[model samples]
Target: MINPLGIVITVLYYKIAEKIKKISIFSKIPPIVIAGVMLIATLEIFDIDYDIYNESAKYLTIILIPATIALGYPIYKNIELLKKNKRIIYTGFIIAAVIAILTTYVVAKMCNTEFIVIESMLPKSVTAPMAVEISKGIGAIPELTACIVALTGIFGGVFGHKILKLIKVKSDVAIGLSIGAASHVIGTARCIEEKRESQVVMASVALVIVGIITAIIIPLFIYLIK
Candidate 1:
């Protein structure tokens, strides 16, 4: 049986998130987080089965691919800027990737975390889909990788700008790279909301580059380390 209530709940939560975002103080809270909390509360109150809800709402997840592809428009519009800053962009991407991997490894080691746990965390900065694939290739838990990736996105989307500002990162490219490299899609959404086309382009570009690099390099790195 089709669950229309699941779809209705998703739509209503999104609208509520939009409304919450319009308020002054709550404006900084990421809409996804608001929608997530609302969804959980609603599910509990209504005693909805998550499995059934997810099955009915699976179409929403499918739309993410096209939405990601549509980011090409912004990248095309700022092609000149991307070309002009190719050196800086690639440098930032490599450095960010290295730092992400190293930090995860070191922290996991310090905690005496399992090797598989460390491996899963290696791709934590990338988007969930890529991270999950990378986790699988490296023999890590995909579900754990997805959870870490989501938490990273939520944290970065909420505090990324403030962190960049605190560090005096005034350049749009640098800000975009930092946020996108650390947070993925959620961070890109935050950039889009800022209405800065250049930031949006660079963030999207960084995300794509990081995803590719993580997918390729992380597997090789894991092999070498093993």
Candidate 2:
């Protein structure tokens, strides 16, 4: 049977983490990251089995499905913007997918990292699920891919807007696509926090489309290089 105790503990930890995020130094850090770190420490300190804790905590991932669908509201509200910029937006998605994959590959190769590690890192820009499947096909470690994806999301969510501002990027859609393409749902969630409807809409769209584009491109990229 599922353990409500795990759910209760996880939720409790998450709420506290959210409050902690209000601190100046921590304001840029994600609540999930804070909560996750604390939870891991608690588990280690107590010698608790992670699988037991995950019994109820796994259900929370189920909530993500509906949460993702709800993001469509912003997209619907901003339909005209998408319609007007369909051509540019479509082209941007392809570019976003290609650049993310290529940069990771090129940099990893340049650093002379192990090929398996590089493969695992390749799908880091996409969301977790897509990254896992892509990892399987490409000889990447799913566990490492998941970690990379999370870290990628955190980096983009924390630094993306600031970098955009520094570069004088003023367009909401451009910022949204850039974040979403690089960080997936986590970056999109950041847009929602800022309450920018245009960014939210474009980011919501960008994460999904960019994942699709990345999935399609990876195979072809592997084949061409081989």
TM-score winner among the candidates? 2
lDDT per residue for candidate 1 within 1-226, as digits (tens), equals: 7767777879889899999989999876666668878988878998988888888887776675676456567557667876886887888988888888878888889999989878888998897767776787788998688778888897899899999999899988898888999898889889998899778878888887788787888888888878
Q: Which stretches of candidate 2 lie over 4 Å from their true place?
A: 62-79, 129-139, 189-195, 219-226
lDDT per model vs. reference: 0.82, 0.85
Q: Residue 96 error for model 2, in Å? A: 0.6
- Name the best candidate (by lDDT): 2
lDDT of 2 by residue, 76-100 (tens): 7667877887999989999999999
* lDDT of model 2, residue 210: 88
lDDT of 2: 0.85
Cα error, residue 221 of model 2, in Å, equals 4.1
